[model samples]
Target chain A: MKITCPSFKYWYPRLKSGKLAANDEQLAINHLSTCEKCRKAANAIEALIEDKIQPESDVFFSARLFARLEKSKPSHSVFIFRPVFAYTLLLSLSLFLGIRLGTYFYYQSSIPSENISISEEYAIHSTISGLDVFFQDDFNE
Target chain B: MDENEKFLDKLQSGDQQAFRILVEKYQPMIQAIGIQMFERSEDNEDFIQEVFIKIYHALPNFRRKSSLSTWIYRVALNHALNLNRKNKWKKWLMNGLNLIGSNEQAVPQMPGQIEENAEQREMRRLLNKAIQRLPENQRIAFVMTRIDGLSYAEVAEVMGISEAAVDSLTQRARQNLRKHLSTYYKSL
Candidate 1:
């Protein structure tokens, strides 16, 4: 029996997973079956993968991170900030309403001034009754 | 409070214990990625810490648009990559040294024959080294898939990329490794 290359032998599963095509798997299997060295290489790859680990934790690190974040003032300002936000919102609405009401009343009062001035001109333009009588005598003469 | 919401509430309130819980629960995941993506650095732990810190502060603003873990993972991955870029020159120099150093000694292999019963301590070390050499995107994807064992969709969420992108990343990473090992492969 021919010894296959270990790496090619190892990639067999990956091939089965469709990550490697049939041709690639065949080549790997062929080499693995023929080469003992390749088999060992494949074994090593397998060994390596089986040993992977997650990162270790340092409790102190978290403590310090918390300390830094806590001591960091920029983020804390948001706590008191929400109320201020609400207050400002109310303030803005009140100001807007007050300005709108004032403008409405002011404009309403201003319109009558134009009517008063037109009536004053109408009074002045009325023909005097005594002037009409004098003009009547002149007419008779 | 459900786990995520409670954690978020505390995080928003600046609860230190809550932060600790978050860190403790997730540090392993973050550290695994860091080790895989970067060579040994004294600053790695700091980078991980910063990642968590950012998550803690940003949690309040985090609309539940995504899961908390996914958001945290994204933060961790981005921080890890940023650290990787900042320390690239240093990593390159160390990699050169490692190449020269590896020539003289074949690292010891784990001795065990049983499934999950074998001493994987050493093999794990080698795996970490190999993962560290992977390109940034590949390393992150590999870490998410191989180390964290997250589904492709979850990995996509953490990566802010499509699932297709994650799949491609893993494939490309494997190809890169295959290329890197071509000489060793041919020799074998």
Candidate 2:
């Protein structure tokens, strides 16, 4: 239906598209009345558009859909077993233990260093010095 | 509350009856979309179910920004587009299977009304396949505007595109359909 008529070509696309402007509508309708080719073309286009084959949903579609939807919702057991919840619990447990162990180790490391009195320090040095002297004397002998 | 607002309230409150009513209301529209947007073999209760399932989940987030049906169409159109993109491979697979063996079932010639309905369904299936060959936007625009008989503005609203854009799409669609459909349209 590619008529060389400028107006036909101009309006054909719009006519087929169902978007012909108000002004062009009357012109198209009048042209369509006179031009058998464009009319046949229009009829063919209409048939193609109107060849409706809408498939209906089966009777049980809703039942299957709702069943699937019910399955998709999280259950209490599923919530407890979720990876995020499991990982968070593990991380919290690890963090608590890490803090407690870190504190214990920190205190253990610092206790003697901070709490040793001058006398205790002197005693330790003197003990080391005596051992050094004893070893030195034994080596000399 | 108005009908939609009240319906939205029931939906948000997890009312099963409200959901059922909604699904029943929109089944035909979604089915019409599925027929055009999906392959004959690809469209099933599951496809519609997937769409309605999406709608079900998203209902909680519905802002009433547009009418629920408009929003549902938007969602369905998006889903169909996405699935069709992914289904390019499925088409090839189906074609391969078809080549291996066409498993068309023989229909018994029943009485008048049943046989007529079957004939109608067969015609629709072939037409759907023809429409499926169209590019995504063109196919949707063509279906929404022509087959669905939606106004260009209404289609624009559903597609979230401009009316001018819808016009261009539909024009191209009509031209393309006219070209391809020249023989088949006459035969049908």
Candidate 3:
């Protein structure tokens, strides 16, 4: 069976702090005694952990941090409904309706009046001049 | 109210004090990761400021899809990474030039900067440089664990991946770092 490369996983914390469990300490020491590669790897990781350093504090920025926090205050409205966008929409809608109505009225107004003229069966007054001719003869008789 | 909800409420109401509190809590963590990922010569302060600006504008629209910290960290990380990646080529060219000028002058080193001592500083710088050289995912995984001290679960939650993925990423990160550090220390 191939001895898989020791995952070296368990060694990280041990290597970092230079402390080891009673059982693992001997094993790590034994392995390092013969394996130069593993030894160097262990020392490097140890150095890294031992070298832990804190970053510099930005006092001025931090002092201003609270003041800066004020700047991040979320606005009440998620979406800013701009007056320009609203007015543009209103104008577009009005223009569209006006154009539609104007087109309809203009088409209607452009039609010739003769196309819808009223037809009369006869000239009523001209025909009615002697409307009682038969009735008057009957009364005299 | 939960801290996050309260913070959301304050933000919605336009309370600047609340915003400042949030930045103070998170900026150090963000700055650490930003430095790990980017060059010291870059405008990291501006980048940090922009992250806050985004959080400010985006807070109103923030849905509770993730925990507030995770969401904030995601935004911060993405912004930092994007900025770093954008300047990568410029950094590479400058790095070449700096390497050539390495012998020109006794570089003015800060006096008290040696507080950590020579060995510790070298190790940290080496570790930082190694992490920075990693692929983006590996680098974030390394920094999130080693520097930020986030738990594997927290890292997983922040990355929106399974715990198993976080484990794998972290393992890979450590494996890579171990290899790089070995090479780095060999020359010393």
Candidate 4:
């Protein structure tokens, strides 16, 4: 019963799955007994397949988790600075500032030039009337 | 409503007690994952807490597409993998430093007990390292199926892969582990 490495490989899955025929399983057992390398490989594979060490949780695990959860809970104010609110605030402020600037510019551009010239004429006329009063007083004296 | 749905509803409605119940129910599963995934024992508690915290935040958005257990498995596995990736480099450096500074002779042990225990620990550590070295999907598949005792169908559901895919991944993972362990034992 000469079992090649490839033959062992073929039988290995069946051996692990317990699906190998009784004679084939005996043959594999014989081969493993004679071959130290194959036996070591089999042991290593078994160890790998074995259940891993289960970690034990502390008795207060739930309490600890709750504590941590409480500590990490997001405050209500966190919503105020959320990206959605921040973006909305920025857009509204920009729109308001844009409208205000636009209105100011429109008013500046819409006022007639004649209004400015008429205001200047009123100031000169008032000054001339004051000068006439001074001349009339001098003539009466 | 099912127990999970009721629990989820309470959680979404700001029921702290319900959230605690949820954490209590899943703590062992999360701890199991953390123990397998993390090298440090102390990190398991923190890792489990993080998983539950994530579940808490994500619970409201959880549609009942999968069972709560399956969803929790997915979250735990994903979080563990992410944490494993993020901490890999740091863990390696710390391990290296420990190896350099370690004094094996300082600890007192029984005449034969020390050698046996050391060998066992070494083998376990090597096995863990091999599993960690595997690709993410394969590692998850292997851990879920072998370590966590999940059936292929359950693993497939949690991983969102086909049952056949789970079978293939587990097979490949086993082969890879065998190769790694054989090489490592030969070197030893």
Best by TM-score: 4
lDDT of 2 at B173: 76
lDDT preference between candidates 1 and 3, better one = 3
Q: Rank the candidates by lDDT, best first.
A: 4, 2, 3, 1
lDDT of 3 by residue, A56-137 (tens): 4465665554455567665565342566667888899999999989977875676555554322112222224554555444
Please tell me what DockQ candidate 3 reaches: 0.08
For model 4, residues B7-107, the per-residue Cα lDDT tens digits are 77888887988887777767766766665676655666678888888988898898878888898999998888888878877667877878535522122
Q: Indicate whether candidate 3 or candidate 4 has the larger lDDT.
A: 4
The DockQ values of the predictions, listed in order, are 0.16, 0.16, 0.08, 0.15
* Stronger candidate by lDDT (2 vs 4): 4
* Candidate 4 chain B: 10-residue stretch with minimal lDDT: B103-112
Off by over 4 Å in 1: A1-30, A49-141, B1-3, B90-135, B185-188
Error of 2 at A40 (Å): 9.6
Candidate 2 per-residue lDDT over residues B1-188, each given as its tens digit: 68778889999888999999988878877766765676544454566788988888888898888988789888888888888777778757878878535634232221122446543455445455666688888898877775344567888988889999998887777676655544443333
Report how closely model 1 matches the true complex, as a DockQ value.
Answer: 0.16
The residue-level lDDT of candidate 1 at A121 comes to 34
Worst lDDT run of 10 residues, candidate 3 chain B, spans B103-112
Collision pairs in model 2: none
Fnat measured on candidate 4 = 0.30
Candidate 4 residue-wise lDDT, A11-53, digit = tens: 6656665667888888888888898877876776686566553
